[model samples]
Target: MSVQFVGLKEINGPLVVLDNVSNVGYEEMVELVLEDGSVRTGRVVLLEDKKAVIQVFEGTRGLSLTNTKTRMLGHPMEIPLSTEILGRILSGSGKPIDGLGEIFAERSADINGKPINPVSRTYPRNYIRTGISSIDALMTLIRGQKLPIFSGSGMNHNKLAVQIVRQAKVTKDGGQPSDEKFCVVFAAMGVKNDVADYFKSSFEESGVLKNVVMFLNLSNDPIIERILTPRCALTVAEYLAFEHDMHVLVILTDMTSYAEALREFSSSKGEIPGRKGYPGYLYSDLASIYERAGIINGHKGSVTQIPILTMPNDDITHPVPDLTGYITEGQIVLDRSLDLMGTYPPVSVLPSLSRLMKDGIGEGYTRADHSALANQLFASYAKVQDARSLASVIGEEELSPIDKNYLEFGTYFERFFINQSFEEERTIDQTLDLGWKLLALLPREELDRLDSKLLDEHYHPEDARMFRGA
Candidate 1:
C-alpha cells in the first residue's frame, strides 16, 4: 500500500495537528513516526482546512511537531479474531496486555465496523441466562440485546457482571448448542489491580476461563486507551458470534471513565461541548458501540452486551448513563440504600426495568406465569416499601393488619430478592417461588396486577391467614 506524508503542524497534550490530509474520517486511527524512531498510533478527531487534529494513542509523552512525520494509515483500528484468542488476555488497544506471547489469529477485522443494515437485522428472541434471579426473573436478557447495568459507586455491579459472564448460558430446552451457548468477553477500564485479580481469580475458581476472553485496562494505564477498549471488545464479540457461531456476552465496566476520556480528548482539540461539556456526537459515538449487538438473519450465533456504568454521584441523569439509557434496551438499576442495608445485588426492582423482558420471558422462554408473578411481586414489594415508610412515621402499632402484612413482605423482599451472592445461581422457578413466599405474607386481595387463576395457582391465601394469625 502506498502512503503519503502529512507534516505535523502543531502538538498539544496527547494531540497533534497534521496538515494536508485528503481522506481522513473522524475518529479514524493513523500511524505516526516520532523523532526517536518510535512508531505510535493516533486518531483523527477533526478536519478543518485540509488539517486534521489527531489524538495520540500512547500519549504525546515524547513527540514534537518539528520532527514528527505523520503517515496516514488509511484505515481504522481493527481487532484480531480467532478461536485461539479465547482464554487469552489483551490490552484496551487490542495488544497483548497480559504479557503472553503473540496470539495467532485466523483473520482480523476492523474495529471501526460497518453499519449493520436494518434489512439484514433479525429480531433477537433467544434468552441468555445470567443466573441472577433479579435479572433472569425481571430483565430476561435477550440473546442479541444490548442491555447496560446502571449502578452507583461501591455497588456490587462488578461482581454481578463477573457472575453473569460465568453463569450466562442458553439452556438445553432453548435449542442452543451446549458447546457455544455460553461464552463471555470481559473488558475493564480504569479498574485497579485487585479488581482485575479478583476477576481473574473468579474466572479461574469458577472454571469458566475456557469460555471467557478478558481485555483489561488498569487504572494506571494510559487514559487514552480507554477509548479503544470497548471497540476492541465489540470487535471480538462480532468475531466470536458471527464467524465462530458462538453466543458471546461482552461486559464493559466503568464506562464513565471511557466517557471522561472522550471528554478530555474532545476538550484537547478545543471542540464545542454538548451536555456537561461532553461532545455533541457523544450519542452517535455511544450508538456505534452499542449497535454492534443483535442476531443477524442466517447467523446462528449472536452477540449480547452487558456494559456496566457507574452513575456519577448516584445521579441517574448523568450524561453517560442518561445517553446510554437512550441507546440501549434498558437498565438494571442498583440501589445505594439497599446496598448500605447489606443487600448483595441491591437491585431496586421498582425503578429498574427491562423492556425486552416481555419478549424473552413467559409462555415459552421461562414459565407461563413469570410475567404476572414478577409484576405482582414488584407491586406488592413497592407497597411494602410504602408501608415501611408509614410505620417509620406512625409506628408499627398504628399500622393496620394489612399494613403490617405489607411491612413483612418488604423485609422478605430484601432478604430474598435483593440480598444475593455471585456464587448463587437462581432459576426463574426459584425467583417466582421466592416471590410467592413474599406474597404469602400479604393479603391476596391486594394482588390486582395478577389474574385470579395465577393467584390461585401460585398464591396460597391459607398461608397468608396463618401469618396474619401469628
Candidate 2:
C-alpha cells in the first residue's frame, strides 16, 4: 500500500492536471499528494492532448501546485464480494463504513467495471410486491429488473421504501424454490440523519433487518464518498446472488444527492458542463449505477434494483429521472395530488407502468385472473376519472346514472385501492379480487378488458358487495 505518485502539473478550476500517467482510463480514480503534505484521491474525468483532467476527491482547499503529485492507481475503486458482509456495515467508498471489522471476500472487483454481457442477460419476469398498491397493483416491480421511482421533495418516497422492504416477497407460494425467497440490499446516498434512522427502524421493526444489508451514506459523510455508495451496495448484492444464491433487492434512495456529489467533484476538476452544470458524462455515469441490476444467465441468484430518486422542482423531465427512464424499465410515479388527498402511497396510477409486468402477473405467477382484472380496473377508473371531470363542471345532479356510478367508483378507487398504509399487507389474489369489486359497478358489457370465462366465473353480485357497503 505504498504511495504511487504520478506527479501533478497545474490546477485548473476543481481539476488538477496530471502530466505523466500510464493506462489512464476515463473515470479512473487516482491518489494525489499535495505540497502541504496531505494526500487525496481523485478521478480522471478527461484525457485530452495526452494530459488527464483529474477531479480531486477531497476538495482543493489549501493545496500548492508546486510539488503536488498525481499517481494513477492503474485500477478503479472496488469492493470485496462475500457473504461475510451480512450484518456488517460499509462506507460509501466501497470499504467498511460501520465500525464493524473489514469484510473478507474471496475476490475483489473493479468499481467502474464492465457491463454484464447481453448474451448472458437473464430476461426479467415475476413480481416483487412492495405492499403498496400504487406500486404493486398499478406499476408492478418485476424481479431481476431495474425500476426507477420518480418523486419530489416532501413526497413519501422514504415511506414508500420502508413499505417496500416490509412487504416485498420473492416467491409465489409453492412456485419458487424455498432457498430463493427475496432478500434486500438497501442503500441510501446523502440522506439526512432522521431519514436514515427511519429506514433502519422500519426494517428492524418489521423483522426484515436480519435479511437486509444496509449501506448508508449520510449527509454528514464526505461528498466524494457519495459516488461510491451505490457501487458498494451492488458489490454485496452481487455476492449474495452469485455466491450465496439469493435474490437481492437493491434499493438506493435520493439519487439526486449522489448526482450532486458527482457535480461537485466535476466542478472541483474544472470539467466541461453538461445540462444544469452537471458533468458532460452524466448519462454514462448513470448507466454505471443502473446497469448493475439484472439476472445473469445460468446463475441461480439474481439482483433486482429499485432505485428511487427525487426530481428537482418536481420535473420528471429533469436529467436524473429522464436519463434513468431511458436506461431502466418503466417508473412508479408518485402523485402529488394523491398525496394532498391523504393517499398514503400517492402513486399517480395512470402514468405509472411496468414494461416487465407482462412477464410476472397472471396465470401461474399470481392469480389466474390477475391480468384481466388489472386492465379492467384500469379502464374503468379511466372512465370514472373522465366522468368526474365532467361532473365537476356540469354539476353532479346533471350527470347520468352511469356517470354517477363512475363517480362512486372513483371514490372507491381512492378509498379502497390507493389508501393503504406502510404496515398493511395483501396477497396478490386479494389485490385482484379488490380490482374485480371495483369493476363490478360498471355493466357486464363494459368489462371488455377481462376474458369472458374469468368474468363469467368470478364476476358476480358478491364481487361488488364490499365496495357497495362503502
The Cα local distance difference test for each model comes to 0.82, 0.79
RMSD of each: 2.5, 2.7
Predicted candidate 2 versus true structure: per-residue lDDT over 3-26, tens digit per residue: 455445777655777665556788
| Top TM-score hit | 1
Look at candidate 2 and tell me the lDDT of residue 250. Answer: 93
Angstrom error of the Cα, residue 440, model 2: value is: 2.5
Best by lDDT: 1
List where candidate 1 sits over 4 angstroms from the true fold: 4-7, 23-28, 172-180, 461-470
Q: After superposition, how far is residue 118 of candidate 1 from its true place, in Å?
A: 1.8
Residue pairs in collision within model 1: none
Error of 1 at 341 (Å): 0.8
